[model samples]
Target: MPLAVVDAQTLVDSVALGAVYALMAVGIGLVFGVLRLVNFAYGQLVMAGAYTLAFTSHFHPAVSIAACFAVVIALSTAIDLAVFRPLRGQSPAVMLVTTFALAFLLQAVARIVDVRDGTIGEPVRVVGRLNRAVDVAGVNVRQVTILAIVLGVVMLGLLALLLGRTTIGLHMRAAAADFRTARLLGVRSDRVIGFAVFLSAVLAALVAVVLTVRRPLVTPAYGLQETIVVLVGVVVGGLDRLWTATLGGFAIGFATGLINGVLPTDKTIFLPTAVFTLVILVLLLRPGGLFAPRGAATVERV
Candidate 1:
């Protein structure tokens, strides 16, 4: 890799991508922490939000964004109630399969809804202004890229505060640490899990907004690949620890973006191949997780 080829713009964009992945990592990790469920359908929540934004694009930007949030959160809640809550005691493999099924079902439904308007995809016009670039220290940066970084930092900070200072947050932490013991100690399992779903949904909604600002087209598979990549990062970073999982997400995203920048334009199509090869190398070196604590046993969570 030629260091001279990677410019300030690439660095900024990579950080922004990492920030977005970090948010997704936190979302996925939140549910996994409490329920031991990977929630493969998480990207569907983002897809729903993106579709909501597309459908409501004719409305005021505030209303469209608000609708996006409402739709994603509601869909997430519905999935929790209809599927996850019912299978709470099932084996992890069963739950994982359920998520896979739910993901495909949601995608099929999205495709149907999309083609009902005689189109395979919809454009989100509400936030197109975010595509505009602004000069930052002599480097041009997209407004949405800046927003992603800011949102990631703010949300992570807020999450840290919530987990550290609030009662529900403490309850959640306790539940994540040891669900059976926490329940024995009077922690409400349903409430903690429900709250986790809600937080994850919020993050999905935020991710949808940021993603649409970058790619305005809302397709059935809009967030599918990103979710998969983030899952890889979460596991590679150490699913056993939330911070490690988040760091993994950010690291993978940064690496992907950096690699894309370094690769020749014609070879950029091989991006996924290169990224996964790097992932294989990382796992070979640190099977437990790149950010996991030294001497901690590696346990598969999902």
Candidate 2:
């Protein structure tokens, strides 16, 4: 690649990568806020959404895309009701194991399906009047990555509004604070959980589309990468805070991309590995997160 080309690539990669990270992080963060347990199976939702697109693109691209997301939400909600909700009365440790088990189940199912029907790999591309370029410190940058940044901001802003302003949002916040208290106040805990599950499902859809637009073709094992990145983001951003996670996701993406652009190509893998190690170390030092100010807080019931 030309020198000029490399610069644009860095910017493009940063933004595109960041969007995917944010998508995974946000959903994980929200789910954690509600249940206070990590959904180890969360990656399956993304894989499900992407697979839907792969299967449906030829039959009906638009409809299939919608179906892809719908399926994720539906499947996750099923798990929540059938698996998580009933087990909620149990200890969080048990729920953690349950989610991990669910995750493995999803992975096994995906493998079976993949073996039964080989994927028709396809790249998703959105064509329109392209801005194509803008000078940045004497280098031209592509427009698509900037668009990714914009989309991430818009989506996150909308999510913040929904959680901050909506009635269900209030209930979630209250429940997160104190599940018992919220139930006592007539806030149906199930409904709140359902809503959390619903949003997580939707996140699956949104992430699939955004990711496909950036890099077409989905693979069966894709969810594992997403799960890892989101897990790191949540730890780095501070598990209790949404915005912090968002910021951490983007920051990690940018750092990784920039390093990839600048470092020796052979050694580039170290960027992600190092970033992940740093995130883990930071968490060990500050268990709540880099952004969270206080000690591990047990949110009081309302």
Candidate 3:
């Protein structure tokens, strides 16, 4: 294929990647809003969902996707019950380190399960049709790419409604603003955090399904790199507000796609270096966040 053709494909791919990363940013930021914890293990939830999809590939696609959601939500709940709940009042550093430990531990567990079949990875063919491309404006665009963009818009829109129009959303916003004050005013912290975890897990499972279509092989380390990049975006966009964090995620993912497409194929190894350099520049210019308000306070707000 011509390099120009590849670059064009990369352009579309970048948009899809940005949409997916924005979803991830919402997942991560939701937890951060309530718990003030980064939850580095967030990627593990996606990995678990991917593994579920892989293991159940023989089932109908709908069933496999449902199972993925079930497994991820269950794991997320378990983590909240065993880890977050117990470590609730701990310092941010302690909670952060615990999430790191949880991430590695989940990865190790995944590796053990993954190798049981004498292979290091599993293929999820349930949604393989998404890998096929369609002609769009004289260009071949993957179905998954279109699906991702549509899904991103729909999910984000629904989320906006949920947060802005629902009672639980109001409570969550209140809790995010000031947990102590919200609690004093009768907001249930545990309920808010649990709901946040549930929503985050749902997004992770959806991401797993989309990702497995992009890369069907499910490995223990699946979603790890994406999580790291999205985290950078969360910080870049401003951790103080959910919308800004999400925008940051999309921006980084979009930039990454462009950079990768522009670089010589063999020199793609420097993609991270280029991406982080951009991040450094952005941070130096606006340490508060690219999308944050001009005089946004340091306090957290969803």
Candidate 4:
């Protein structure tokens, strides 16, 4: 294959993978920008969504997908209200560890649920994977991938509009810019913050279905990796800038998948390191993120 063709092939695959990551990263980044703390159990949200899909897929697949989305968002909101919200005034370190603990609890729940159900998790087909391919500049690519990319674009656009053009969006922006100012302006900062957390969960839930459809195979162990990717994208993109997070997720997905394909080894390793290394360099050269900073910006670009 020509060098250009080879590179292009890898890129297409990367973007397909990136669409899911972009969804995930934006969620993490959105939470961090709004509430300067990490939600370690965020991955569990995805896992929960997947398992929800797994169980429901047998009955009504469409309903299962909807249930998964609803469950994730509701669970995420519950976490904010029940756990994180109570610890609102705590140190960042405390919040981080709390979120981490939440992750463990979620995983344990998954383990117990799976054991009771007598099943091991794997990718459940969301839509029947089209074996059909459309030739894209000599590469016979799967049609599903193209469709997935289109969906990703649409979601991102909708989210952008939701954030930019809505009253809820205005409240979110006001809080993100300055919580105190937001309160002074009658924004009810606490409620505003709760909304941010709710939105975070909803976005994370959205990623769950997107990913299950894109690559359904997942185990409880997958939660850790998903958490890391979402967090990494948040960090790399500059937490405050939505586009940066989106770009960062897509960039990492592309880089990781591309490297996974090109390496001579039978198994993939070091892609996370390689991706983070690039992010670190970007941070050293341009702190905050590739985009401008907002709020306290705990999401260092590196």
- Go through the candidates in order and give the clash count of each: 0, 0, 0, 2
TM-score, predicted candidate 2 vs. hidden true structure: 0.84
Best by lDDT: 1
Q: Give a tens-digit lDDT track for model 3, residues 1-302.
A: 34545457888999999999999999999999999999899999999999999999999999999999999999999999999999988988899999999999999999999999898999989899998999999889999999999999999999999999998999999988889999999999999999999999999999999999999999999999989999999988987788999999899889778767776677777767876786777667666687888876574334
Clash list (residue pairs), candidate 4: 123-216, 123-217
Query: How far is 8's C-alpha from truth in model 1 (Å)?
Result: 0.5
**lDDT of predicted model 4:** 0.73
* Tens-digit lDDT track of model 4 for 1-302: 23333476667877887887787777776776667776777788888888787767676667877888788878887888899778876877899999888898888888887767577665566654543578987987777678658867987898889789999888877777776778788887667777777766776766676666656666776557867875676666666666787787777776666766676455456656676796677567656666655444443333
Q: How much is the lDDT of residue 288 in candidate 2?
A: 65
- Candidate with top TM-score is 1
Whole-model lDDT per candidate: 0.92, 0.73, 0.91, 0.73
Q: Estimate TM-scores for all models.
A: 0.95, 0.84, 0.93, 0.85
User: Residue 286, candidate 3: how far off, in angstroms?
Assistant: 3.7
Q: List the residue pairs that clash in candidate 2.
A: none
- lDDT of model 4 at residue 51? 79
